[model samples]
Target chain A: MIKSVAIQGVKGSFHHIVSQQFFDENVNLIECLTFDRVVEALITKECDAAIMALENSIAGSIIPNYALIDNYNLHVVGEHYLDIQHNLMALPGQTIIDIKEVYSHPMALLQCKEFFKNHPHIKLVEDKDTAEVADRIHKNKLKGVGAIASVLAANIFNLDVLAHSIQTIKHNETRFAIVKRTNSEVAKEAINKASVKFEANHKRGSLAAILNVMSDCKLSLTKIQSLPIIDTPWKYAFFVDVTFETYADFDKAKSLIKIMAEGFKVLGEYKNAKL
Target chain B: MIKSVAIQGVKGSFHHIVSQQFFDENVNLIECLTFDRVVEALITKECDAAIMALENSIAGSIIPNYALIDNYNLHVVGEHYLDIQHNLMALPGQTIIDIKEVYSHPMALLQCKEFFKNHPHIKLVEDKDTAEVADRIHKNKLKGVGAIASVLAANIFNLDVLAHSIQTIKHNETRFAIVKRTNSEVAKEAINKASVKFEANHKRGSLAAILNVMSDCKLSLTKIQSLPIIDTPWKYAFFVDVTFETYADFDKAKSLIKIMAEGFKVLGEYKNAKL
Candidate 1:
């Protein structure tokens, strides 16, 4: 069992909240300022696992996380989707009408573009973290500044939630994965999901050939995304996650894909999370 | 002859530099604040053509432009790659050592993360346009704030270039495409190039089958990128640009690809730009 998890940002950050949902509440928490540092800590064994949010339903995929996952060779042990409820938080006794400025991460600001558009007079300030914005407002006693953050941030920072779920998209949820240094053991009880990253030759149809091998193996693909190979212009390597009924032809599938692909690496195998 | 081209942002922006390279310096300039406005100007016949930077060599693909190209129905008439040279600009006598704040577009700031890391004391500010940062500094006569912008911005704003080519990567060339409302008549006279966007069924081997059609047709693909369909999670549609030595089997290639793929749209047949 994982005893500790390191996440980027402060206590009230979405990563912190998501980490709590996956691990024991008393688990040791290592806070880092950046996502890269959290991944580094896990790779260096400073933490048992690292939890990072990869995508928001409203904001789309966090593309940088895709690169980090591929670069660090970390295995995604499990994933959970947290329904994101963005709240406008301010120091205690402050009201929404009192806000002269609103602060949050740039992406959070963008996600709340509709709110800003409606309240055009409020100056939108970009900060490093959403929870940090609330913490600053509370610590600095900024009467005119509010933060767009989670309800948990408001509670932790002793701020009042002025508005709830102000995000333009009502179904906003962020998908986070728990990444560990080692891959999970393949279970014999039931078929599990697997993820792999592969590079295809620059030639046309290279990616298609790999997909054909999966089809031939009777695997059901869940998700596939392409991230540019940084060194190569106009070339991309694909990351794919697939589900299998059993581990019966898994090795054969892997070999066939290797024959069709220029390079491939199995990221991890885990029981598919229940939505 | 093409008389004028529309582009996004103010003069000294990367788009402006690319447009100047594609069209002569004497061409009329139509500046818009956003990419969508540039496309609208071309589609509405307000401009003869428009140039938009679609990707930076280091920043991967500009995913938003891909969606705009597909939705706007503009024909890509030419392509150009411009080497990006970012400069730290400030009022005439300001030096990098004296700077307390730096401002640029978020993307530009991200490209220079290493530089920012070294100058940790400098507060980084995000602005809508890099050139605008120069303009603001010039107008405000701010002593300690600097802007990361083009050399043209420094010249136009009468600011000094404190540092040159501060990007993380040395060869930071940005790829741009010229789009027009009408197809180029010179397309057939020059080397044939084809652009297509397609969606594959959410099944394994679907994308490969479509690519096989292109390989079978002997077309060389120049660029391929996947943009999230946005409305769906973990689903993407791909856009591909292919070059052909001759137009002999182009129609057959399209038909074969269309049969194998879902929602295929041929953007246009255009001659590759000499630059």
Candidate 2:
């Protein structure tokens, strides 16, 4: 059982919420300000596991996070999908008209940018964290300042949510991966999905031929992302997420792909969190 | 010939530099603050062509731009690759030690994040545009403020260069697409690369079969990005760039893939800009 977790942000942040829901609420949290620091904490055994956002339905994959996970050789233990909700909050009893400036994470600002188009009077400022901004507003009693964060942030900081779910897309869902230094501890019977990375040979049709192996083994490709191998400009490493009905099929495909593709590595094998 | 071109920033941004280099220096520039506005100016005929950055070597694909091009039915006339260099500039007389804050476009700040690690005393702030901040510092005579922008921006704004090529990665490159409402204007003899979007059937290995067809036609896949089809939960639309030795090979593969893949559309057909 996991006891301590490393998250990129403090309490009331999305990563914190994931840690609470994925593990027990009483779990100890080692808060980090950046993804690199989170990885460092995990590598040094400061925490037993780390929670990292892998992909979002609307924003797509967080490519750098994928690089971090791969470069650090971390393993995915499980996954969680969270419906992201951005709320406009401020000191209680103040209206939107009273707000002169808003501060939050740069990404949260980007998501709720459309709502701000109508209110040209308010200036948007990017801060380090979403919930941290909320905490600052409440502690300092900043009246004219607003924040784009989550409902949990507003509740914890005693700020009134002036607007709810202000993100442009209604169905904004982010997939988070629970990672550790060790390989997955999930049981084979419960494993329905796996994330793998592979580099195809320079020969033509090599990538397609490898995909054929997965299909013949009854693995369903859910996601495929190609990241260029930095040193070798044109060549690419393919990161793919596949789902299977049976573990036996996945095992066969894994063995075949390892032999077929260059630099083949299993990033993770865990339960599919989608359904 | 191209007359007015729409770009996403002021005269000294990377996009602005691309506009001048891709077109002539005498071409007209319609400046917009956001990518959405850049698309609006293009769709509304405010400009003849718009330059959009498709992918960065370090950051991977800018996924939303692909969606915008596909949704607006824009045609890719050509592609350009730019070597990005970020410089730190400040008002005349102020040194790096004197600078208290650095303001720039979020992307510029992100790219040069590693350089600022040693200067923990300096605060990094995100702004609307990189060159605009240089202009602001120049006009307002902000003594202790620094700007992270291009060399063109520093020259245009008459700011002293405090540091050169401060981005974490030295060989960073970004690929740009020259898009217009009509089809590609290049001659067939010069065309060696094409960008195509397709959705495969929900059957197993449908995507692999499509790839097999491309390889059979001598088309070498260069870049492939999969964006989730919003309405369909697990389905994805693949955006791929392929290059060939001859245009006839690309044409044959295009026809075959069009017949095999669902929603197959050519986003752009132009000369490969890799070289």
Candidate 3:
């Protein structure tokens, strides 16, 4: 299928990279400047689907993205994990010695802090987007300014890599979710994973009871996040992701959770991406 | 004893208002520009203690603050829920019609969207700080500019409130946690609540088993947040907030949870703030 995938940030961004790596090369790309806009594009049916970076292995969960999914009633159709490589890039002629200031998202800068520590002369400035900085450096011919982004960004913007994999941790990765508007969820024969959300009172054992159902059904609990319910004070809505070996096991778990939990909603049911 | 409290943002910010309402008025206020700085002040003993907004009723959990408390090994001594009222204020004489731009934090702007919908002429702009915008408007004597901040801000900045409690939700509240360096958690005889974090395997139903232990101990689970363990990609550390009627019940639950959960650590044990 020729899918039109919406992603936050411009071309050569991590979302863009994920689109290329996860989907067919012939797919049309719709670039969004904000995660909210990406959600808007999907909800309004402006794009077939959207890719959202849920959490960086190093930086932690993008909480707002979770809220966006829940608020917009989006369905998580699939998931992908991409290894993050933050490369220091600038104009073709620029080198480590030539650059005076470095610009990237605060998180990208934070990941590459140890590298920057060795070179104290280069001032670090936090910007909104990593690829945006790379694009700016390329377009504005901004010399003495470096951007920390992906190698793909360097290739796309026609910039030279002053340093490769400059992030402090080499094993940094980000989990991206392929989400479609809730109305567009198509059922498939082979499904082994599900994401569900529920709200409950602060009973002594209610949450534990819900999890026990998942256990009995042989579902592997991968992730659970608690989001405070906006209107209800001191109450929370829990988002849980579970994986199972068989479709029967997942269906049993889903039905059990739905019966046991309040305001239960299944976000998505698809094949486990990690496999 | 005289107390020194650290709060994020300038004077008259929401955090400052929380500090005043939550603590003794004699506290020496240490104003911090960022939550990181507030955490630093608590960790380094620059202040006797600190107040950090953990979550909002509308916008949801301040997940990063949970990371800060866990990473810094800080102790949560108390908590306070502040009813947030976002006010639109400008130069004393200028009315709503005269104002051109309304600036506040993105969340504040969002909360007041219904009010802004009525006043289509006012352009909503995202700013770094709410009180800071009020401070700027006052400092510069800017007539056409307005800020969405607290009543305290309007008073501190010498501005007139054009609209009061303009948030879409009338009962908006933010939960703030009182944290101190680990040294301050002296034995309290009447402890009723505790915040603990535990790391565990992703085995099917393993987390449920741990929760069962808590249920058996009669501890009421108020909140549970799963934060990504940065160094270990898929593994998560769950931060659970539980309240109990008796310290004995909590101690029993804590001990059992320790045996079942990996890397278990008590973040704090304190008197239940809600009670």
RMSD (Cα, Å) for all candidates, in order, is: 3.2, 1.9, 3.2
Model 1 alpha-carbon drift over 4 Å, by segment: A56-61, A169-173, A186-191, A222-236, B43-45, B91-94, B116-123, B138-144, B182-186, B189-191, B222-236, B272-275
lDDT of 2 at B91: 93
> Would you list the clashing residue pairs of candidate 1?
A208-B208
Across A1-275, the per-residue lDDT of candidate 1 in tens digits comes to 77889998888988889888877899888988888899888988999999888765444456677678877888887787788778888988887778899989987887787877877778988888889988888888889899999888888889999888988777776778888988764465554677788886556666666777788887766666665565575466777777776777666789888877766888777777743
**Predicted complex 3: CAPRI docking category:** medium
How high is the lDDT of residue A135 in model 3?
92
The 0-to-1 C-alpha lDDT of every candidate, in the order given, reads: 0.79, 0.90, 0.84
Q: State the TM-score of the second chain for every model.
A: 0.88, 0.96, 0.93
| DockQ of structure 2 | 0.63
Over B155-217, each residue of candidate 3 has an lDDT whose tens digit, in order, gives: 999999999999977987788888988533546576788888998777887888889889998
Specify the highest-DockQ model's number: 2
Q: Which ten residues in a row have the lowest lDDT in candidate 2 chain A?
A: A200-209
Candidates 2 and 3 compared by DockQ, better number: 2
TM-score of candidate 1 to 2 decimals: 0.88
- Residues B1-275, candidate 2, lDDT per residue (tens digit)? 88999998998899999997889888899999988999999999999999999888787888889889999999998999899999999998899999999999888898898999989999998788999999999999999999999999989999999999999889888889999999977899999989999996445798888889889998888877777777687677999888888999988998898778789999989988786
Better structure of 1 and 2 per TM-score: 2
